[model samples]
Target: MTSAAENILERPETARRTRLQELWLLFKENRLAILGLVIFVLFFSTAVVGVILTSGEDPVFDPALIRLQEKLLPPLARPNLETLAQGEAPRLGVYLFGTDDL
Candidate 1:
């Protein structure tokens, strides 16, 4: 007669089947918990992919354009006289929802 431990060790497929059966039983007993886990994983994957895709390029500096008049300006601040006289809308990088404003 074979021992119980020997029988389990002899069949690797049987061990996998046993584990799957236990998981199925647990899922059946806690359906909502399993569903919540699936939803969380889906949202986490979407957020990670979005961050990877939407990052912007680095800004280049122009030493000639760096005048004392424009020093210490915050981002998306009002445009200087040159930009206004040229009739060009101030380009504040991408807005979250794609509006002209910052």
Candidate 2:
């Protein structure tokens, strides 16, 4: 057999790359893909951080915990003296999209 034919028949001993790794390599070559990746990461990180920071006892689950005086509070609405006296804070846990019912 010719040397070229012998070389073509030989298998390399190095480990093969994974499909995901290969895809990532290809994805990194595109500028738009990199931008999209960054946006996705930022959104994901924001969601994760919001969840972590918002961790607390949820009052919506318990009917008894609901205060009629505090119902239907607007977003970023400052707590009144009466509400504060009853141990309520303004905004009620960073309502990013706002909440009609508190």
Candidate 3:
């Protein structure tokens, strides 16, 4: 029994290599899956690197020093304070996404 076990352990590594080669062949045959995998890896790397490089910065602290008056103003939309005061038709721009109304 020990000799049989030793023989099994001493067998050639072809089975493992064959499986790896088969996997490689399959991966090569699936071009779309390979492209998707590459894209996913790239995006993941970019996100990881971006986070690592930007982690030291304080998000709350605006480096541009925007005034409080400018805070919460909607992007691409002008303030409608005057319209609100007059109760008239408010002129608003198309905010692609909802802006932080200051």
Candidate 4:
């Protein structure tokens, strides 16, 4: 019968789908794996978005322009109000993740 033939043809696909569903259920049972998956997705999306947004501009930063005088500053080293008044701080934005000069 055509119904029997259709069932036979679909059996392998149904088995494969059941296996994939079982694997997904097993994966969801692990809290740490879920957290890691979330973190990975966030980082991956951030990198992809950053690349797209910066595509028109220079892809690489010229660290050589970063002066020796301005090197090795800690993160968020905001100038004091007095220093700002005196115009001592670099015109660049806040150092959110500290300097890369070690």
The candidate scoring highest on lDDT is 4
lDDT of 3 by residue, 3-60 (tens): 9999999988665557888898999999998999999999999888667643655432
TM-score of 4: 0.48
| Candidate 2, 1-102: lDDT as tens digits | 698888877957688899999998999899999999899999999888767655657542233344555557666655455554544443344333433553
Q: Could you tally the backbone clashes for each prediction? A: 0, 0, 2, 0
The reply for model 2, stretches above 4 Å from the true place, is 2-16, 58-83, 90-102
What value of lDDT does candidate 4 attain over all alpha carbons?
Answer: 0.63
RMSD to true structure for each model, in Å:
9.5, 5.2, 11.0, 6.7
TM-score each candidate: 0.33, 0.47, 0.39, 0.48
Q: Against the correct fold, how does model 1 do in TM-score?
A: 0.33
Model 4 residue 69 distance off true place after TM-score fit, in angstroms: 1.3
Candidate 4 lDDT over 1-102, as tens digits, reads 999999899876534457888889999999999999999999999889767644654433233344455556687765344534344344555655456664
What order do you get sorting by TM-score, best first?
A: 4, 2, 3, 1
Instruction: At residue 28, give the lDDT of candidate 3.
Output: 91
Expressed as tens digits, the lDDT of each residue in 8-97 for candidate 1 is: 888767344578888888887897988898999999998876665545462232222333444555655564666333423334431223
Order by lDDT, highest first: 4, 2, 3, 1
The model with the greater lDDT, 1 or 3, is 3
Q: Give the 10-residue window scoring lowest on summed lDDT in candidate 1.
A: 93-102
